[model samples]
Target: MLKIKNLHASIDDNGVLKSILKGINLEIKAGEVHAIMGPNGSGKSTLASVVAGKEEFEVTKGTVLFNDEDIEDLAAEERAHKGIFLSFQYPVEIPGVSVTNFMKTAINETRKAKGLEEMPAKEMLKLIREKSELLEIDRKFLSRSLNEGFSGGEKKRNEIFQMAMLEPKLAILDETDSGLDIDALRIVANGVNKLKSKDNAVLVITHYQRLLEYIVPDFVHVLLDGRIVKSGGKELAHELEEKGYDWIKEEVNA
Candidate 1:
């Protein structure tokens, strides 16, 4: 459902171009979960942001194809409207906008883009309640400003709740396990597992294997120095956990 061919990206102005993704080649099929693990500055988050069309980064080369269309040229909102959902590592707080209002606007905008009729308020509210319940979020949480005054766990749960509501085709979760305790991790993983379907895919970018034990990816890849140096099955995560990334670095430099 998603493909990246020889993808390369850089940051800052043209003068400060330092390529973070060096010829990345990846494919994520529907009904699958792919995990990307890497050390600090390995470009895991940069890849996610570039795929989501974040404006700060620039693609120096290569292409990103969503479905059959090339999405490298699309704007971030356009990519989102096309069933691309990104759960940021740092959830942004909107001080005045209630979560309910924010979600409603996002859902409606997506629907309108797909030529679907707007959902009646009652129907939307019902769906939101059901999803919120599944995430164990109180209705009052919906009335609060988005991420404002929310604990770290609360922010992550809220991200999953929004994902459940949007139901995007491809969900890119960037460091979803960061700052989460075991209980909160289980809750978040359960929500993601429940949302998985035959027609959707998830790309989980994490620094550790702990989250993989819960969410269980179909494939695992190790990225180093801005490129994927190794790709393997779920067991690769176990190996990394046991031996650490130094083994991989040794192998790379061998």
Candidate 2:
């Protein structure tokens, strides 16, 4: 449901722009899961941010199309409203906002954007209960402030819970497995797998292949030096795990 072509993005460093993503071309159709595996500073997350419309990165070239429309000019919130959800590597802490309260506001705001009335209190409550239970999130946990004092697993699980509630067409998970324990990873991956459907797509960006053991990707792409130098099937991830990115770099440079 998402297509990116020849995307080049850069971040400004004290008034000078430093290039990050260079010539990234990818297509994620509905009902597929795609993984982006890369080493440090390879612009894996940059592609996710650019597609999510993060303002810090400027897209100097190429186009990002969601479904069939160009969203390169849209703001982050606008892209979110259009069914693009990005799970951050580091989810920010909101001191006083309970998870339940935050979800209520987000859902209603999206509804408002679609010219629909607020969800009835009863329906909203049902949704919260269902999604929390789907992600195995405790109701008591939901009562706590969002991401405040949460363990790495709790934070990542909470992000998946949010994704469950939002039900985006394309879900971009940017290093959700970072710092998560094995059990936590399993839980988060289970939640993501359960949420997968023929109507939605998932893009997982990570440095390790372990996460793929759970939420298996239909395709894997290797990003090197800000460009996707190689694209292959799920087996490619295993190859990368066995042989580091050096071999891919060599192949690309050859």
Q: Which runs in model 2 stand beyond 4 Å of their true positions?
A: none
lDDT agreement of model 1 with the native: 0.95
Clashes of 2: 0
What Cα-based lDDT does every candidate model obtain? 0.95, 0.94
Clashing pairs in 2: none
106-220 per-residue lDDT for model 2 (tens digits)? 9999999999999999998999999988888889999999999999889999999999999999999999999899988998999999999999999999999999999999999
State every prediction's TM-score relative to the real structure. Answer: 0.98, 0.99
Cα misplacement distance, residue 195 of candidate 2 (Å)? 0.7
